[model samples]
Target: MSARWRLAPGERAVWLTATTLFLLVTAAWLEHQITWYLAVDQFGYLTFAHDLLAGRVYHEWAPFQWLARTIPPRTDALAQAYVYDHGRLYCRYSPGFPILLASWIGLLGDDAAHYLNLTLFLVLLSVLIAVQWRLLRSRWRALAGTVPIVVLPTSVYLWALTPTREVAAHLSAFTGLFLLLRAGGRGLAPWRTAIAGVALGYAASVRPDAILYLVPATLLVAVHLRRRRSPFGVVARIGVVGAIGVVVGLLPALAYNWTATGNPFRSTQGMELDQFLAPLPRSEPTPAGGAVGYPSPGWHGGTTSDVQGGGLRLANLPRTLPANLAFLIEAYTPALLAAVVWGGVVALMVRPLVFVTAVPYGIVALLLYSCWPRPDPRYLIGVNLLLPMLLVEGTVGTLDLVRRLAWRGRVEAARRLAFVAAAGMVLALVGAFALRPSTSFGRLAVPILLIAAGGAGMAATWPSRRVVAIVAPLLALTLTGIAVARAWDGLDRRAGFQRPQMLRARDTFRRAVEPRAIVITTEDIGRPAENIEYYSGVAHALYLTDLARWHGSVFGVALLAIQAGVRPYLLLPVSDPERPKILKQLAGVFSLETVRDIPPAQAVEYFVAAPFHRGVHLLLERITWPGFEKEKQGGPPG
Candidate 1:
């Protein structure tokens, strides 16, 4: 607390700026509640967090059960379902994020757990910003000029709220970078390197992919050592110490995986393997008295819980790369390419060491993501965070360049010219804002104007090369305002599209069934099952593939339900081409009938508006199993 007050005004502003952004995000959350942005990964994390709190490491069954009066809709339809290991069920995800989130959930309760999770993140983020703030002030006081840039781009705020491990990854990676930069300047003490390594390793624990950050750091160190003509023994010793720290940090994850899946290297997400390319289906036998006939053979595929036979292949990478690249660039439009361009320039001119240490990681990240089968924007978040730092460095480098040029003569002429150019740019942006057609473009225009104002102000004050001090905060405020507007709009959009449908579905389900009744459905993904199980103690839910030995069939779902001493009920697409065959297959084995019609809840529709929404509306609507009966009848469908 004392240390906080000791901060200089600019440093304190950094803290306050982060705190303000955090508050705005939290306010959005309070208004939207936990259901907003409910992805499958989040359900797993929340469920796993609960499991951890309850003293269980592996979940053999779904955890929720409630009187069938109602069940919340699981919004994360694509989240991975539980995987079977030699007949035992366990979550197929890395446990790092959940393990960290568990203590917070226990402390805050289910409803407020997310708020607490994010609040804790704010505290950590503030610290990270403070450290970086101090570092920037020391190395380049001109960096204060770029302080406003911390408002970040709008996408960043959106990502911060999502359930994915990226936020934790960002935190860990940033903290590690801060530590590493500090260690680099402070004589690279053994403990400092080890701690930085450990911090990076923790980032990996949160999201395994973060280990890539170390690749550049290591290269940078080697280059620095080479440049300094360090002894081989010293380099070897440093490498060994760092390696030991990373391993020690990663041990918990390794042990957790080995215990859960018998393979420490195998992440439950199974993302490395193309999920869409699963093995060919083969006939297998079902359990005795099982409605269908054979036990389903488990196989790893893409991220989906249901067995899938096809997907975007590696050959598709060439085609996918362009759109992904465009989206990636658009996503980081806030910082522009200042970090990327200037970061390189600054490294070459001021700190060649940073180029050696951190730039390679960015390069590797680019290559790795570009080649990835699926090009999700979330994967590049860490790189986005790094971009601003680069931008700051670049801004400072520009100032230094100007100072050098000024010393060579012609200072007054350059200053006058800069002022004229800056004023012209400001006028152009204001004119463009007035002429903008759409609200989206209009939203961006305001920030563009602010950026121009920063430039103009810097020019007017001429001879002051540190434009960052003038531009950074103004730009930060501009982006922050835009981010706030987007957050509200995004939250509202989510509520309009998914929230109502989900609440209605849950209410419908509660009214449709009695308490303690088992639900057997084709929708066996983690989110649905977890939601049902959370509300109801009967965690017995199975995917269609969970029943038959053959892949991609709903036949086995009925069989498993029968064997569990409960009548089977399925939630399936009524109009699907496979529906007729599926019903025929169950004809003599179990009676089938529609309990209720679940209207279309395609997430795409909500996001895409009007005509586009209709495209998927026809495809995703589903129907449930027959009405619940107190007693099971041995007869076929009537």
Candidate 2:
């Protein structure tokens, strides 16, 4: 008979309380949002989700969309990412996330939809515990693996606030990989491998780049499949089954593409956004007022245009990798580099099987994001998911190595290494919290010092490595909190972190226009048309215009839309010198009226420009041609 460990009543209560507090913390970050702006990705996904619930293909074919297709001043990165194909307009985000979101919206109300982050995260943690329990068969070990994610300040908080595909993708990929781990390596569990393939395939559909993690995952699975002296035919059969499962999982995305573009092989998103392989030019500082009336290249740093090559180049791994490692260090630990390296080496030498299964996901995530042009802190969220497991595995592997060494009569050397490991923790803390880690040197030095700090103080009364397994994380959490706080100031400066003061401002602007009115925004206060549509029953397309060079032609198209029975309103910045000239041009064509002044929304909107950290005001003027309305006349605005 075998016995299993169970928690005492008080221990159970403590665990419950700890879990509740972590949930509350996550909820609070969701409410505050820490720092982020509503981008095209969020709205695009939501629109697709809405379309799915309407019982039609996830695309639109309105007359305004025709205008959008024909419009000149369209910025693919700036406005809602819509691709026009086969007479239907589709939001260019993949349908997998939207399908998941639609299901959530259908089951629960829209208000409860955000809870997907929390709920899916809970499922992921549950699955992680199950995987660890399966491997070690110890409740304490399972809890140890799960605790960092629950207790530490990881990148998951940054993701949970946004209505993107992150948490779902994370859950899907992690679930897939760990399920394979749960299957004993020596056994032939075809069902588990098939299901894992399905999950990973679904993950790839949701976030196409997520498929990169599968390379390492596949290697791990292949190693396990061959662990036993099985015939080649058996392993080949299992692999074929998994391959079939991947195809089955991809059917939904393929079906969606077929419905939207009349081709199963090509997605509407791929139609417009196939230029990622081509590198983008870094933004040079345009003067406060460029020759054009544009507001200094505008704000919103969500995609490639914002800071694609800010300091790191995707092709140059040497420079790019270190910068990314610095970022991960700032996120989790200054000791991250040391701990991960030491862990990987020890796990490889001592427990190659565990190393292949567990460590590769984090390694893949790191290398994958290193190649990403977007340097946003949120890029490492997936890596954060693996850290707890990696730390646990690494610690166990290191201990195992030390035990082996001691068995070989190297007790003194092992003890000396343990003392230095404790010293490394001290140096990591000092470098993280006490110093200004602005320079690359400062950032990389902390982890390097962790290895060779021979003279670092070690008190006789100090707790053992067993005690540090708890204390070090609590310290790392503090370091992460400080690092994130420091990074927030830069993110706010660089990323489009804003107050929903724009919402209140939009509320005032929406009251003056009908749902059918198309708002022309030259000012980048926001692309508010989507949110406007969300609140109202519908919203006409927001036709964005070039700064000063192309307004004449754009306004001509606006007049054409007016002739086609579309009401047009020009949303301009009050401080823009081009506003008066724009109004005068419009007045020559039609009777234009000032609707209201859009109050300055408290926000920090920079297009990789120097941060203003303040709000910009907007002037809303309605362009109405009574001749077009009463007499059906239109050439210019008049």
Candidate 3:
């Protein structure tokens, strides 16, 4: 008889407690690290929430507005505000993340939105761990599956501070996976299956890529039911129940798209149109006459504009699989590659059904992501969650073989020596990552330590399956916490090591905006635009994109009609390598208009220019040239 069949109560409790603590610490540490490192993305989310609360229907001008609708408004005043009035009508992006952000905004204030996102990320991670534990029914396997995720180098690094669509997408994908696994088999209860359906539906809504899992999950369940030879009525009932649950879960997204875009299937068309329209110049050259004219240019082959066409091509293909795989490998850290391969090998052996289910989902995710012009690592975040579970299966299967050999006593010495060697490798890897923060080292080291430690801890208490179960989770959690701490310190140092231009950008935005005056600057001002919009409640005031030129024309006309006295508050010279002539022309024009320079620092000279043609001399007076001496001392803002 296998020794694991027997177990004790005290050993179980210790293991359980340790595992719980480890997960808690790791989750918290990762949350902190990601929040700190990538806080910039939250500005974008907050902008969406701010718009949603105001009730603007459009997703363009602001992407991810769909996520905002999930949260109820916090105040009646906020709820009553018109979306158009708040600048939401012009938003141009998907609404999934915005809807989610909005829900948090309603429950908590705008200030708490990022925290809510972080909390959601942690919750999703916890749920994934719990689900893996339940499905595998092995402590070691579950820990092995979850530890990589908790300490996943990229996952920790990205999660530190950005409340991005990628984060939400990951959460949604995990929820879907959990639901699919929990619903499709003999061990699942009816209620659990229904709940799983709902989760799957919600995941699909957050990221359309998750929809690919539905076909596989449904087929898997249908096959399971068919083999059981249940009555026709039972099958019919299950179908209806699952369908209803899925429809109900999807209703929110369906209704949102239907109301916002006229077609439930289409994303925010307004946003897409805005992106398409914004890229085209106001004027174009007449091919017939060597003369520049209106209607700038139509869409050509480029990264962002080709997304739809790419999606179409991606929808049909076996040839594209290699490209998709390459994209996935490149987007994820090396650790994921090792984990996926190891986990895949193990999953095939231990739970072939899960392996099968995961394969299609991964394939679809890769293909869909590859089709995108921008292949951000965050896009594949959730898809990678399944890897940990696979690793768990692989580790347990290997350990089982080792246990059998140990019992035979024929190769126990060799096994022990191999274990020691593995331990040394893990320690060396971890030490390297701790000393040097390379994504490669971190990814390789974390999983090695986690798998090694988990395997060792389980073996020590094996034959007592209960004890192995308890210790596995604890060890996994401990490793995750250590990785988190390490990640946090590394991120902090990176964020702190900024150039002088970055510092100047931060400081310039802080002082530029006053109560009601609009602050106009060139687009692509990097962190400065974010700072101005965030610090100053002046979203309309700071025009950073090319869209600002259009807005400026309108403002210029209004100023001319109203005879409203406009003055130059601050002007920062925009440096561009590709368009040096344009930059020079802009500078000469500003100087001709008598724009003054305000010296902020030795690095950046701030200029004050008024609205041209409306009180042109007052615009000149507002613009002070800190003189040629100041210009000579400080080069343009980089």
lDDT of 3: 0.47
Q: Please, what are the lDDT tens digits per residue for candidate 3 over residues 45-131?
A: 566666677786543432113212322231111111112323334222345677788888898875565566567766766776666
Predicted structure 1, TM vs. truth: 0.71
Q: For model 1, give the 10-residue run with minimal summed lDDT.
A: 287-296
TM-score of each: 0.71, 0.77, 0.65
lDDT of each: 0.50, 0.55, 0.47
Q: Highest TM-score: which candidate?
A: 2
Which candidate leads in lDDT? 2
Runs in model 2 lying further than 4 Å from the true structure: 1-17, 28-37, 61-80, 129-154, 183-188, 261-263, 271-297, 300-322, 392-397, 407-409, 427-434, 437-510, 543-554, 601-614, 630-638
lDDT of 1 by residue, 1-638 (tens): 23422447786577466447645664564345333324346666777778888898766452122211121122112124445444344665567778777876677666554454455445444545554454444322222322222244324434444345667776776666556554323456667678877877888887777889788667655755776677888888778888888877677678778886578876555444553344322532221111000111222123333332233335435644675666544543423343356557766666665455446776677666655444555666656555555655544434444444455686775476456545644665555546523333345444544564456456446654645454555554555556555555656543332345544545555665544444544331212433444433433343343333224245444444444444445544445455577678766545655555544554222121122123222222222333322234544433
* lDDT for 48 (candidate 1): 77
lDDT of residue 423 for candidate 2: 67
Cα misplacement distance, residue 586 of candidate 3 (Å): 6.7
lDDT of 2 by residue, 1-638 (tens): 12433446775565455444444444444444432234556667777788889987646635445355453333232243565433456666677788898999899977555566656765776676666665544444455556455334444545565567877786787777776773432374788789888988888778766776677568767777667655888788878877877767677777877876678877555533344344544553322321110112354333333112232334534445777676666555555546666766766776565567557777776776765443444556667665655565444435445445555777666666556665665666576666555442243234323422321222112223333333333333333343334434443232233344434435554566766676666435544544444443434545343213222344665677676666777766677776676667666557668776655552222111123325566656777767567565434433
Candidate 2 vs 3: which has more TM-score: 2
